[model samples]
Target chain A: MRNLADEIERFILRKLAGETNDITILQRNELADELSCAPSQISYVLSTRFTAERGFIVQSRRGSGGFVRIVRVPVQKIVYNKPDNIMDYCSPEDFENIIIKLNSERMITAREAGLIKYFLDVIDDYVNPVEKMRIFRSLLITLENNS
Target chain B: MRNLADEIERFILRKLAGETNDITILQRNELADELSCAPSQISYVLSTRFTAERGFIVQSRRGSGGFVRIVRVPVQKIVYNKPDNIMDYCSPEDFENIIIKLNSERMITAREAGLIKYFLDVIDDYVNPVEKMRIFRSLLITLENNS
Candidate 1:
């Protein structure tokens, strides 16, 4: 929260945390007003932080009633059981460790682990570190609950 | 046996081989005449060989002046070095088995395999199986060669 960029990222991440599938639909101008920063600053942060390499999919619409939606998609809510701080910023390795620990304790079967691992394998390709965590958590949760 | 399709396939592969990152482009009808075949045959080989799953990104333009561009993209070649049959229709398990064998043989380290496994974990989630294959193969190849 030191810099404006980090602040915006945090605001978005926090908003996404309480969402289903880790997706948050919001307007750029409203977010800029809330952050007391320029709208272009929001765009800058998003462009650099939320990227395909980082696992974020950002879409925008222009003109009246236009909006910007930042989505960390295909991720569901059950993966992160950590404290809010940790859950807000997690890693793929963090996910791997949790699943591995779960498997070791017999909380999940090997097949389930494989399925969870499969989810991890796919979402890990997303590049945004912050988004990577939420995406991993949500997908793991979905797969865990589904299976 | 020099099947026309195989001949056309080899001709394109050979042409791509001598280029940077192993990419090449050609006119469909022109290549057909060079191989003494129909334009549709060129499309067949490209549709098969230069697939996203097979580690290729093919972009083509239609109409009288249309051309097809076959880009090798960022993936290295060795990931596709399995037997022809294996390469033709490989699965996630096939890739996993290959990496495991390589690990056991110490051709790739546990760390390397882990890295490969990481890529495997993420790319597996791609909805398109063909894209999943190519993305995994290219990333794995890049990791293997770099490490």
Candidate 2:
């Protein structure tokens, strides 16, 4: 079911989509009033949806003269660095961030991201960490070539 | 290092690629002789590399008349059924299989599959099972619409 968070996300996304520089600034209180919701709701949506993994970085200043800044990360800034502890067993949250990063960078499509998440959710425990790392590294190399 | 197993996997993949029907059969002894490796080595490669998780299936007739049959699963026969215990924490192996199945069906590209695997490997533990399933189901719905 669509909720206030969904609506807020769509509204913000629409605003960003219409911008030429892939960025936008909003007055938080104004946005809240426009959306007919509380300012806290806007904060929640911004924090969750406008995350780095999702290709967005949101900066907001609190109080009467504050504004929110949403910037879509560009491709050139991506370093594609493998984590230092990549050889160890990766936690699910970290894996999710990678998926988000890929989608945000336009390295993969949304559907592809979804497909990846599905696999992550259902992956068997018996597939050991070493095998997982091997697969992950091989996959990154493949994307590096394609992207 | 290029090991016997890697060579054997390549040889079989090459053979499968060249087949018009996406299926192939070979005598284990003949393949071992041709590859100049032990038959046990061939068995290891077949069991590991040519697996359902990688979108492959092997049927072997044991004994003196042994033959290995490799068949690539087709798309139409996919049931897309969510497992009964989907709400529970998913293991790595099961997720790997889902990724493989998606790749095999051509619903996702090899690079995309790899990207998915990377995320699966690194996903954080804090992202609980319920949230994982929610994200996974949404992703599937998106793919269903796109595919």
Candidate 3:
């Protein structure tokens, strides 16, 4: 039997692959009914599978006419010959490629991507893991919540 | 009389300024007694003042050998002689200087600096003012959260 998280993730990916761009809205209760799960289960799926890192922007409205909208971002096309060299050296072109790809692939909303790019520049001059993690986590959380 | 809030805040800040990184082993009840305040006051101070937003991290243990530890983070120095001089013209040398200073002062972790350099490349590529602000805010928030 497929678990709820897996089900939700599959459903979301399917929607993204199908070219659903203008906010795929779903009501919590209605989705729960359709999936035979609790409303909180929907929240769980949104929190985990649709995180900013993996690249999906989720928004919701509460009360009547309430619905959750998921936007798909586009992925960038950069020819990486070696995956091992991914973070070895990050240049402006590399960062831009990632952002462009993330936006196009629907991994991040335009607003979230914009925010992330801004943060990347500010911390660019600093060289420390603790600080990088700090910035990365903060941007991730903000994008997750705001998107 | 200085209230518990004021006293605890001062004590924590003083310890932090004195280069104390670990303070979790301190006994709450004993601390309250030393300050002639209620134990709950300590809890209140920890929750409100030492939050991640304030750049202080707090952790506590309960039961036998229970204690509270607080770590104070040193404030980041943006490094320009004038605060009004926006970081628009920072050279590679300037960037390197900031990293060295932060590392020597123990202000940022090595990983954080690496991430920052990655982000810097992104900022250098973007020419738009709005884009710059967004990136700057994102990096600042990330730095603030990590430290």
Highest DockQ against the true fold, candidate = 2
All models: lDDT? 0.64, 0.68, 0.60
**DockQ (CA atoms), all models:** 0.03, 0.17, 0.05
| TM-score for all models, in order of appearance | 0.30, 0.34, 0.35
Error of 2 at B97 (Å): 15
Per TM-score, the best of the predicted structures is 3
Residue range with the least summed lDDT across 10 consecutive positions in model 3 chain A: A73-82
* DockQ sort, best first: 2, 3, 1
TM-score of chain B of each: 0.53, 0.54, 0.49
Q: Candidate 2 chain A: minimum summed lDDT over ten consecutive residues — where?
A: A74-83
Task: Give a tens-digit lDDT track for model 2, residues A17-55.
Answer: 999867788888888999899989999998898887766
- Docking quality of model 2: it rates as incorrect
lDDT tens readout by residue for model 3, B6-37: 88888867766676443334678988998888
Q: How do the residues B1-147 of candidate 2 rate in per-residue lDDT, one tens digit apiece? A: 235777788888889889998899998889999988788888888887887755577998988877999986543234245453334556667667776877776655676666656654554443565666555445546555433
Instruction: Report backbone clashes per prediction.
Output: 11, 23, 39
